[model samples]
Target: MGLADALAEWTDVDGAQYELGRATGLFADRTFLQVKWVLWSSNPLGQALYDMLHALVRAGVLEYRDEPDHQFRWRTAAPIDGLDG
Candidate 1:
């Protein structure tokens, strides 16, 4: 199988990927803690996951939102299209 297929199977077998699936469908603003929770669900000790999120914010692929509920730290952004190009 290809990389994505393999990764999907791995996450599926581990049951930790459910949170990620749920996160993708969230249309409302998401908090930092919520994003952290989703990332942590896959691997709590994965510093790379946290770093990747920070990188996205830095790249403007993800933007920080000042939701009243949050103090404005990487709170929300829809993933932009065609950044890979």
Candidate 2:
């Protein structure tokens, strides 16, 4: 689904998306690099975006965006680093 559609379906507090995204290490915890990479991808079907986005969708915690830097962050209730899939 598109980011706009994802945002429309989100019914939680606005801050949670950031925590989830940051937790994924999908961006190296840096904002601009994340955007630059996603927007400038050259891989087939853009696997970088696809793989990372798939995790977020399965986690069911984030609203994707072309400009994710502007979105809020939400911390998961608990963090289990070693067990993360």
Candidate 3:
């Protein structure tokens, strides 16, 4: 599934935060670079989603924290603002 779909599934659970590894693991069949390329591509939908994620961070609806290993850990600070699923 795409990042949006994976995130939707994660939010359905009772847990309030998700580790970056867990999120990445959802797409284990694909290479990380492949996922990165898709998200960074010129596709309008991808761009929109990327923008929305950053907006969430600015809005305090989401937090992207950096770990000591230089990896990121993401979690919702509030209910996701515009996700429909």
Candidate 4:
């Protein structure tokens, strides 16, 4: 599934923050991560996922934050309709 679709599944539950690496790992295989780590380029789907998330941030649909340790977190900007209540 696309990043948006996977994110929707998670956001449907709540607007809690999620780490980018952990989230990406859930959708990608270990080999993909290892190769990308060594090659310095990620898989196409990883790029697409980041692109989608950037779009969401631009649209104010999601909020992106960096923790002190440098990990990124994302959460819905507001309570999702129907799901929040």
lDDT of 1 by residue, 25-80 (tens): 43126544555555446555344444544464577543333343211122233355
lDDT of each: 0.37, 0.40, 0.42, 0.42
In candidate 3 the C-alpha lDDT for residue 25 amounts to: 57
Q: Model 2, range 1-85, lDDT digits (tens) per residue?
A: 2233334433232223322344455444466444454434565424544455546545653444445443422223323454322
lDDT at 36, model 2: 51
- As for candidate 3, its clashing pairs are none
Off by over 4 Å in 1: 1-45, 65-85
Estimated TM-score per prediction?
0.29, 0.28, 0.36, 0.37
Best-fitting candidate, scored by lDDT: 4
Descending-lDDT candidate ranking: 4, 3, 2, 1
Candidates arranged by TM-score, highest first: 4, 3, 1, 2
Task: Pull out the clashing pairs in model 1.
Answer: none
- Clashing pairs in model 2, backbone N/Cα/C closer than 3 A: 15-73, 15-74, 16-74, 18-73, 19-74
Error of 3 at 65 (Å): 4.2
Better of 3 and 4 by lDDT: 4
Q: Please report the TM-score between candidate 1 and the true structure.
A: 0.29
Candidate 3 lDDT score at position 76: 37
- lDDT by residue (11-73, candidate 4, tens digit) is 421112222333556424544345443224456645655565666567556555544322222
RMSD of 1: 12.3
